[model samples]
Target: MTTTIRSVETFRLRVPRDNGAPTERFRAAPRVRSIYPTADELLLVRIATDDHVGWGEALAPASPEAPGALIDEVFAPFLVGVDIAAGARPLTRRLQQTGRERGHLSGIQADAIAAVDIALWDLFGQVTALPVKTLLGGANVDAVPVYMSEVNGASAHAKAATAALLYERGMERFKVHLVGPPEIALAEYDVVRSEVGTSRLALDAHWVHGAGDARRLARGLDERGAWFLEAPLAPEDVDGHVRLAAYSGTSIAIGEAMRHRFEFAQWAGAGAMAIAQPDLGRTGITEAISIATIMGAHHIPLAPHHSMASGIAYAAALHVSAAVDDLLAVEWGPRIAERSDSFLDVAFLEPIGTSGAWIEGGVVAVPAGAGLGIHVDEEAVRRLAAG
Candidate 1:
């Protein structure tokens, strides 16, 4: 049986945010927080190995069309001839080799490589009859612990209400997205507290400050028993983060925008962040695991930045977090009954042996099925693909 990859296929899904109309979700938010988020876009890649099928996705937060074009014109042409059995690590190197000649893979180029590398790993797991995590290393646990992501709304009450709703649905922890100055953040934290009542809440500042503001907010979060503070300062300011970390009582989290291990190494070496959040779709499985190893050396936990990704990308993130020794819970965006118009949901993680959704009671199980352990609908993908 020829398990070598035969063809490459791609998809681009443009799901408008409520048909590009204003809604209570936005009108009720603390402020017009998101700057015209017209839609949520995703790019998916599929690889075939005679007997098995595998899926992957690039984290296309904005325009998937660009990465989609690059995957078709650039990466797919390079990878279609490769062997899945040859291995994901080397195949990743083969992809990066192009960047070495042309330019470093960043932005959409990095995303394209990620989609290809992840699909290769998924195919490898299918051929070997082992889950992707098992291939990386044993899944230290059956279910990867997760924290329910944001519940944004116009008012503090709205945000708290949204969090309460997810908690009723079996989520135990939450992350409140914050923007603006320190006073604005502290007030919202109080709102989150009044509603959730200290049930494991974390604050994502979204790069809202300098050393002084971050220290003030971190001090407040620590007093309230908040889990961690993310991106208090700019992404590249490692020394600034190190300075902030010295005074802040809360753990500092970072690495969502970073492209490689070297950047993470710089931050980790400086003891900047207590937790590292590497995006699986951005790093590809190859560099992501390497980044994990780098973070591990500094005794920093990897929480994995995950959002705007379809189920395929989420599955990849879960598998990596499962394999790594240090995971401080995965980030999940349930969106409180938000639209499910994207075809990506058709490929949600379906546990082979588990009874309920992969997510059950504030935790998600590492899918036991071979490969990424999810079912992707080919017909749906083709319909969603851009020309």
Candidate 2:
């Protein structure tokens, strides 16, 4: 009879990209050696209390089945029948502990925990009739400034044209995803910068460079006044990042691949990165806030990374971004935002009484309802899950 989590459900979705065929989605990412998923793929979790339901998602850009299976085989059993009032963070810590002996502290295990953690926070908010931001203390900003994540196009001129289009759409900040060789990246940077006209440009090297090459690219980005140079070196090269941070004029940004505060703490303590970017879909709200606190202690600003997330996780990111004091901006993917409402019955926000999240004047207002503020269409999600 006690109010508790009555059930937990997980879904793996692989929706094709609107712009291209799914087979083409696996092409090697530009400027980086790794193959990136171009489709909208993610793992979702739904946690229901006696009277309300809450939703969450994980950043499973590819092979969502990994986290999906983990949730079913390991995480879901512990969540079912749990009291909703225990709170998200405590419950999340317990879940982490439950999996600790099995060596599940990181990787896809973190992604599974991330989904459950977000669902717990969303469930907690609904049970309390409070927004997630209020539950995270209180918001420091009503609307968080956003930056368009990548300027897309096969050619530098084409990419600049895309940047110009975004500029016309009121986007004031943008990051370009560049491929190798300092000169090639710099040349593309020049074209995109020209079109955007000094509107706070950033660059992502996709962790392809060694320290020497990264330092060379960092100097070029610095000369052009880049807001930050992200993932310039390989992900494991913490020492390399530290050395680059010491030598480069541009700020070094990292953390999207990282899943917890402990990892971020190491980066912060070593002065390895100047900016920290935690994806809520990867860390969930509980740990994202923890990462933010750790970064804040080091006076490192947070700019959360977002990619291939549905509306639920997108709302979670915005709520966390609003609550943080050291927010620089939330990475906004227009294509993702455009397709986010496919599984939601309600729009992510109430602008003009419509039910979708949109960027206007370069910012996204925090969603206004309890929990994540969006109603998940379980039927739609299930339909997609069947495929």
Candidate that would win on TM-score: 2
User: Which window of 10 residues has the lowest lDDT sum in candidate 2?
Assistant: 349-358
The alpha-carbon deviation from the true structure for residue 246 of candidate 1, after best TM-score superposition, in angstroms, is 1.1
As a TM-score, model 1 comes out at 0.89
Residues 313-376 of candidate 1: C-alpha lDDT, one tens digit per residue: 7888889988898888888775312323345443234222234333444776777789888766
Estimate the lDDT of model 1: 0.77
* Candidate 2 per-residue lDDT over residues 1-387, each given as its tens digit: 355988999888877766655556566755566666777787889999879888999988877889989888877888888898868999898888876766555788888889999999898889988999999999988778888875888888988998898786667789988875888889988989999875889998888887678888988887888999999988988999999999999999999999999999999999999999998888999899989988989999999998778777888989999998888988876566555667875344322212333355378778878888778778989998898
RMSD (CA, Å), candidate 2 to true, equals 2.8
RMSD of each: 3.7, 2.8
Give the clash count for each candidate. Answer: 6, 3
Flag regions of model 1 displaced more than 4 Å.
19-36, 101-105, 335-361
